[model samples]
Target chain A: TQLLEQSPQFLSIQEGENLTVYCNSSSVFSSLQWYRQEPGEGPVLLVTVVTGGEVKKLKRLTFQFGDARKDSSLHITAAQTGDTGLYLCAGARSGNTPLVFGKGTRLSVIA
Target chain B: EPEVTQTPSHQVTQMGQEVILRCVPISNHLYFYWYRQILGQKVEFLVSFYNNEISEKSEIFDDQFSVERPDGSNFTLKIRSTKLEDSAMYFCASRRGFGLVMNTEAFFGQGTRLTVV
Candidate 1:
């Protein structure tokens, strides 16, 4: 079974502060995706990193895939209150497999 | 923007009662999935449906759980007999045919909050 472990299960920071959440795994993935979920809502796709060592940016958020495709990271620059949410990392094994999701990092950016 | 839609945003049912959760995946998506997240927990995959049949399922998806794509767009999950522990927020997701690209990202619905009493 493939598992993605997320670090710093919870994080709270003042608005404008920077933070990074990490997702690690022992198995390789074909692609990795980051998602942000607000209370009472489903997760929204933030970005997807397909190539190893690739970086993708979405506004203030930066996502990176590991060189080995076994891990990924999400870095927030100058985070705003709106950036506060449950951040999840999901890895897709292949075309026929369902994505395996991380436990998620609960981020709170206080204004 | 295309989006996955789930009905009965919230449901409350008595134990032992059967319940069916409904979802309408994005029109052009071919892969459909059902997931559940307990309060304060991570999203867990329940089942994946393709070509009008189930392609994969998790251990959590036991005999009590069943999925069907009755039509071209609607995907449904049925829980034969609900238990107190069955309560959770259920989400429906869809993806345009899978591949190793950004387009493979699955779109999710707001979710249905199920509370089994």
Candidate 2:
């Protein structure tokens, strides 16, 4: 079974602080995606990194895929209050199967 | 932008009662999928349907769970008998079509909050 392990299950910081959440796995993936979910809502796509060592940026968030395609990281710069949410990393294996999500990192930014 | 939609945003049912969750994927999407996330837990894969039939399913999709794309737009998931453990936020997702890049980004719905009493 493939599993994605997320770190720092909970994080709280003052506004303007930077943070990074990591998702690691032992198995390789065809592609990896990052999502941010607000309370009582579904996850919204943040970015998808398909190539190894690839980097994608969305506003203040930066996502990086490992060279091995077995890990990923999400970095937030100058995080604002609106950045507070559950951040999840998902991977596609093969076929039409749904994505496998990480345990997720819960973030809280105080204004 | 088009997004996936699910019915009965929230449902509360008694244990052992059968329930059917509904979803309407993006009109042009051909690959449909079901996933659930328990309160404070990771999102999990349930099943995947394509070409009017199930293409793949996860171990979590047991005998109690079934999926069908009755028509071109609607995809439904039925649970024969609900258990307390079944309580979770169920999400529906769809992709343009399975291809080299189609699986890169699968759009997800707001999700249905199911509470089994």
Candidate 3:
């Protein structure tokens, strides 16, 4: 079975701090996606990277896909309390299969 | 932006009972899926539906779980026999197409919290 593992299970930081969350997997994926989820809600897709070595930026958040498509990272610059939430990484294969998720990194920012 | 909507934000059922979760995917989406997340755990895929049939399913999707797109707009997940282990957040998502390249992402619903007693 393919599994995506995310590091730094929990991260607590003061406002304006920078944080980077990593997601790794031994299996190769055709595409990788990053999502943000709040408590009691389903995850919302933040970005999707289909090409190797692709970098996408969404305001203060930047997501990068590994050249080998086996790992990805999310970086948040000058993070604010509003940015606090559980960040999930999902890998997608070909066909109609559902995406697989990582355990996620729960981030909490204190103002 | 269109998003998936699920009914009954929360549900509580006795063991061995039946529970059905309902979802309304995006109007133009063609592929639907059901996923579950135990408390503080990774999201696990259950089933994926396309062209009025189950195109893919995971090992977690056994005889107890069934999905149907009964009509033009609604997708339903029926748990024939609820178990204690079935208590979790069930999320419904839909994609515009069958593959990631053409459609890209799945829009998820808010999720229904199911508690089995």
Candidate 4:
């Protein structure tokens, strides 16, 4: 089975602090996605990275796909309380395959 | 925006009882899936459905678990015999394209919380 290992299982930082979470895998994936889930809710897709060495930014959030297609990262700049949630990284071997998800990083931004 | 929706936000059932979880996928989506997440664990894939049949399923989807798209828009997952281990949050997801493309992103529902007694 393909597994995605995420680092920094839990993080707590004051408002305006920056944080980065990493996701790594031994198997290559055709695509990878980042999601944020709040309590009592399903994961909401934040971004999808398809090409290696690709980088995308959404407001204060930045996502990067590794050059080898086996790793990815999410960086939040000047984080706010709203950024607090569970961040999950998921990979797909192909378009048809189901997603393999990492255990996720629980982030708390204290104001 | 259109989104996947699930019914019965929470459910509680006795062991060995049958339960059917319901989902309404986006009107234009062509692919559907079921996934489960145990408390504090990663989400695991259960099954994928397309073209009126099961396209793929994980080993966790045994004979006790079945999926059906009875009508044109509603997708359902039935657990024949629930056990204590069956307690978890079940999520339904959908995507708009065939599985051959590289960037098909799935939209997930709010999920149903199942508790077995």
Candidate 5:
């Protein structure tokens, strides 16, 4: 089975603090996606990284895929209370395959 | 914008009872999927449906779990015999097309919380 292991299962930081969460795997993926989920709700797609070593930014959130396509990282700059949620990383081996998800990192940003 | 929608935000049922979780995927989406997340657990894929047939399924999708796209727009997941371990948040997702170039982003529904007691 393909597994995506995430680090620091839980995190708590004050507002204006920066944080980085990581997702690593032994297998390579064709694409990787980042999602944020609120309690009792399904995950919301934040970004998708298809190329190795690719970096994408959305407002204060920055996402990067590793050069080997086996890992990825999410960095939050000056996080706010709204950033508090569960961040998940999902990877797809190919276009027609199902996505394998990481355990996720639960982030709590205090204001 | 179009999005996936699920019915019965929450449901509570007795053990061994049957329950059906319903979802309406985006009008233009061609691929559909079912996923479940146990409390404080990672989201796991149950099954994937395309062309009115199951394209892929995980080991977790046993005989007790089944998926159907009865109509053109609605996708349904039925749990024949629920157990205490069946309790989880079930999410339905869909994507527009397949392949590396086309949009592969899957849009997810709000999800249905199933509590089996």
Candidate 6:
């Protein structure tokens, strides 16, 4: 089975602090997506990375896909209270395949 | 913007009872999927539907689970016999089309919280 392993299952940081979460897998993926989920809500798409070694930035959040397409990372610069949520990473083996999701990193940003 | 929507934000049912979760995918989306996340666990893919039939399904989607797109827009998931362990949050997602170049990003619904007693 293809598995995505995420590190630092829980993180709590003060406002203005920076944090980085990782998602790694042994199998290569065609595309990788990042999502943020609030309590009692479904995951909302943050970004999708399709090319290897690709980097995309959204405001204070930066996402990067590994050169081998088997790993990815989400870095939040100067996190705010609004950044607190369950961050998840999911990978698709192909265009038509189902996504394999990581366990996710739950972050709490305190002001 | 258009988005996926699910009905009955929360559902509670007794063990062995049947429950049907409903979802309405984005208007133009062609690929639909069902996923479940147990409390404090990772989101797990259950099934994928396309062309009025199931395109793929995971082992977890056993005989007890079934999916249907009765109408052009509504997608549904029925759990024939719910068990105590079946309690979880179920999410429905849909994408525009399939291809390496086409946009493959999926839009998700708010999800339905199922509690099997």
DockQ of each: 0.85, 0.72, 0.75, 0.70, 0.79, 0.80
> Candidate 4 lDDT, tens digit per residue, B1-117?
988999989999999999999999999888899999999899999999999999999999999999999999999999999999999999999988745342389889999999999
Give candidate 1 misplaced runs (Cα > 4 Å): none
* Model 3: how far residue B16 lies from native, Å: 1.1
Q: Over 4 Å off in model 3, which ranges?
A: B98-102
User: Which candidate's DockQ is highest?
Assistant: 1
Off by over 4 Å in 4: B98-103
Candidate with the larger DockQ of 4 and 6: 6
DockQ of 1: 0.85
As a TM-score, model 2 comes out at 0.96
| lDDT, candidate 3, A3-109, per-residue tens | 99999999999999999999999988888889999999999989988888999999999999999999999999999999999999999875455799999999999
Minimal lDDT window, size 10, model 4 chain A: A91-100
Restricted to chain B, the TM-score per model reads 0.96, 0.95, 0.95, 0.95, 0.97, 0.97
Report the C-alpha lDDT of model 1 over B1-117, residue by residue, as the tens digit. 788999989999999999999999999888999999999888999999888889899999999999998867789999999999999999999998866574588999999999999
DockQ-based CAPRI category assigned to the predicted complex of candidate 1: high
> A32-64, model 4: which lDDT tens digit per residue?
999999988999999999899999999999999
Model 1 sits at an interface RMSD, in angstroms, of: 1.0
Q: Roughly what TM-score does model 4 have, to 2 decimal places?
A: 0.97
Candidate 4 CA-lDDT value: 0.94
TM-scores, all candidates, are 0.98, 0.96, 0.97, 0.97, 0.98, 0.98
Candidate 5 lDDT over A1-111, as tens digits, reads 999999889999999999999999999999999999999999999999999999999999999999999999999999999999999999999887888999999999998
Give the runs in model 5 whose Cα sits over 4 Å from its true position: B100-102
Against the true structure, what is every candidate's RMSD? Answer: 0.9, 1.2, 1.2, 1.3, 1.0, 1.0
Clashing pairs in 6: none
lDDT (tens digit, per residue) of candidate 3 on B1-117: 688999889999999999999999999999899999999889999999988999899898999999999988999999999999999999999999745464868889999999999
* DockQ of structure 2: 0.72
Give lDDT tens digits, candidate 5, residues B71-100.
899999999999999999999999887775
> Among all windows of ten consecutive residues in candidate 2 chain A, which has the lowest summed lDDT?
A91-100
